[model samples]
Structures are given as C-alpha cells and as structure tokens.
Target chain A: MNRMRIGDLTERAGVTQRTVRYYESIGLLPSGEREGNGHHYYTEETVARLQKIDQLKKVGLSLEEIRDVIELYFTDTSEVLPKRKVLGILYRHLADTDQKLEALGQFRSDLQSNIERFERWLEANERD
Target chain B: MNRMRIGDLTERAGVTQRTVRYYESIGLLPSGEREGNGHHYYTEETVARLQKIDQLKKVGLSLEEIRDVIELYFTDTSEVLPKRKVLGILYRHLADTDQKLEALGQFRSDLQSNIERFERWLEANERD
Candidate 1:
C-alpha cells in the first residue's frame, strides 16, 4: 500500500512508534498527513526515511548530522549537493563503520571467552 | 589507585558524570564510598563495571537485562551462578551480537553503494 498508519509504518521500518514520533518532532521526518477520516496517515516515503535514519545511526552519525544529509537521499537530484561535501560524509561514515566493526569483533571475542570460561567453571564446580 | 573520586572515575572510564550518577541511582553501579573529605570515591572495580555496561549496551542489551547478568562478570567465582541460567544469558547475548553484526554489514554495503552512486553522478555532472 502507498499509505499506512503509524503502526504499519513502524512495523515496516522496524523502528518503534517513539522513534517515529521523535523524528517527526525533530523535523527529521514530516508529520503524517491527516486524512478525511481524521486519522493521520504516513506514506511509503515515511517508511524509507525511517529506515535511512536507522542505517545512518548504525554508522554512528548523530541525529544532527543525519538531519543535515537526509534530504539528499530523497531529493530530486545529486547536482544540488556540493561535490566534496557529500563525499566527505560518505568517507566519514565508512570510517565510522569500520571502527564499529572492529570494536564489535573484539566484543564478540570477549563474550565468547567469557562463555567458554563459564562453561568450564560450571563443568568443574556444578554437580549434575 | 584502588580508590578515586567521581571525576577521576568518569574520566578513566570514558563516561560522563551523568552516566556514573545514573548507574549509581539505578543500582547498576555502587555508590562511591564517602570519606572525611565528603567527596564520594569509586574503585577500579567501578570503572570495570561501567566498561562492562557499555559493552553490553553496544550489543543491544537493555539496562534491566544488563543488570540481570552483570554481576557474573565481577563476582568472586562462577559457583554462585546457576549453570544453565548464566549459559542462557551468554548465549542470548552472543545471538544478539551476531544479529547486530549482520545489520551493520548490511548498512555498510548500502552506504558503499550510495557513495558510489553519488561519485558517479558528480563525475558526470560537475566539471572544473
């Protein structure tokens, strides 16, 4: 469907209602259009915006930075964006993503060790 | 030093004073012990606890969920932990971390594609 309610939008975007409301309040997302029945309805574009926001967040862009660049994603053309500026944002995001990946990899290793240690300790100390 | 003031603790832990205070208020961290100086003091263990909380948060564990399993990391020995329960929590965290890794990988891929598209468009549209 081209139009949906907040519940459907959130379900489709994989974000919470609070997130949608917060984004709308902060101007990162447009407020849903009110229909003739007095119910607010969001379009598929809203779902895409929410998903884009989520993706940006995963790369550690602050909401302010996301606000600055989000329109480029949905806007009519890339010619409007300054050449170097857009590339700068992309490069920074790539760097941020790499750092996160490294950190998460380290964390996963640590978690695994802790798990193994617990298993060994349980085997030694816990009686069946 | 075994004991440090809150300022030092926050700096060492790379967390904000607000985070330290909130953790203390929520019983997620021990309130710093007070001495004759009237200023509260935290220990190295407190720093480690803050770090553990951060790691757990990065893997998407809620504060409540973190509380349920945090002590296992700091407690004296593994015997006190119920064998199956601790294993279950560790397994769940591992699964959560894996899911996060996958999502981040997807985000990274999408970002790369967007960057390439912008680059190509800029090359075609902008000239010196």
Candidate 2:
C-alpha cells in the first residue's frame, strides 16, 4: 500500500492543505503519523474521511456537527444497545435541515415574486 | 416622526447592538447622527432599513450581497435601462439558492437512510 502525505491526501480529496490542517487543529480530523524525516503522513482512510468531511460541509453541517456524525461511524455497533448520542445528533440535524429547507423555499418564492413585479413594471412602462 | 437610538433600532429589529454597529462598520447600514450630548441617533427610516437588512440575512445573503440588493430600491427606476448590478446579484443568488436546496435535499435523504439503518439494527438486536 502506498503511504499518502498531506499533499497527496489533499489533492485526491480536492480540499486545500490549509483546510486539512484546520480540520486536524479543530480535532475534526486525526493527525496520522510522522515519517522518518519528521514529515506527517496519512493513510487511504484519511483521504476517504476528508472527502466525507467536504461532503458534509457542502450540506451545511458545522464542524462540530460533522465531528459528532463521524463518531457514529467509528462506534462499535455489535453491542446490544444502539448509541443514544448518535441518535440525538441525527434527530437534531434532521430538525435543523427541515428548518433550512423551509427558509430556502420561502426565499425562493419571494425572489420569484420580486422578479415578476419587476417584469410587470417593465412591461407597463414599455407600453407608454 | 421621532428619531431612534441604536438601542431602539436594535430592539425593533430584533438584532443585537453589536450587530447594528457591525453592520454600520461594514457599510451595510448607515451611521445616522450625533445628538447635542454627542451620542448617535438613527431616524425612523434607519429602523426600517435595519429590519430589511435582518430579513435579507435570514435568507442567507451576505452583507455585501445585501448591499447590492438594497441599491436596487434606491436606484431611480424612471430610466429605460434597469440597474444591471442589482439584477446580477439577484440572478447569482437565485442560482446559489438552487444549489443549496439541492445539497440540503441530498443531505436529508442520507440522514433518513442512516436513521433507518440504525433503527433496523436496534430492532434486530431486540429480536435476538
């Protein structure tokens, strides 16, 4: 298996080096290992995790929220009881997403109305 | 009409005093007047403007973006050509809003799937 450094992981993930470092600094990402020359290195899993983080960010999840979601995947699932914390995070995110959708929908509707009003005004003036 | 202080404007707009000052500093809002006592005061129109700014922000427009939108209202509309800058801002925001809606929809779908998977695992364990 090829060992990936920060540059390789960032290139493959299409994220900036600064963003990768910032994620690690914020504890959203793990700092993998140090090479012989003292340079940091990452595994393929880190690349995948970076991609996941980017996807979550596009969906408007905060870093803290993404951290909680990531915790769900690493949790041991073979146990009898499911992770209650994961469930709580998911429920909260769902409610938040719903509110965002509602706000965006209304914003879109208002935009359409304003555009129509502009068109009407233009037409009324054009007839003169 | 009576003049308004920053406190009165913030209270009417449901925004923080810090936010009002920040907006003024960023030029999204105008700093109104100095009284005999050297304290700042805002007009009724400023109160209305603050409310408009707050409404635009709720719909996800950045301060810079909101500034462009506000310019549309102030522009003289009697002229034949419409304000191109305002139109550009609105069109760009519309496209951005559509993209956000798409991403949010996808995120909601993924979240629902994860919740269902977790529930299924929980039920399977209960049956054992």
The top-ranked prediction according to TM-score is 2
Error of 1 at B38 (Å): 4.6
Candidate 2 per-residue C-alpha lDDT over B12-95 given as tens digits, one digit per residue, 9 for 90 to 100 = 778899988898898887777886887788877777787767666666677888877764544454463454444556677788
The residue-by-residue lDDT of candidate 1 on A1-128, one tens digit each, is: 88899899989999899988898899999889987887779988888888888877765567988887787788864557676787788788788777778777877887798889888887786666
**lDDT of candidate 1 over B31-127, digit per residue (tens):** 8888887889888989999998997776556798888778877886454767788789878878877877887798778779888988888778667
Error of 1 at A125 (Å): 4.6
Off by over 4 Å in 1: A3-22, A31-43, A51-69, B16-18, B33-39, B55-62
Runs with alpha carbons beyond 4 Å of true place in candidate 2: A34-37, A73-82, A119-128, B1-3, B33-52, B71-82, B124-128
Which candidate number maximizes lDDT?
1
TM-score of each: 0.75, 0.79
* Candidate 1 local lDDT, residue B87: 81
Model 1 chain A: worst 10 consecutive residues (lDDT sum): A75-84
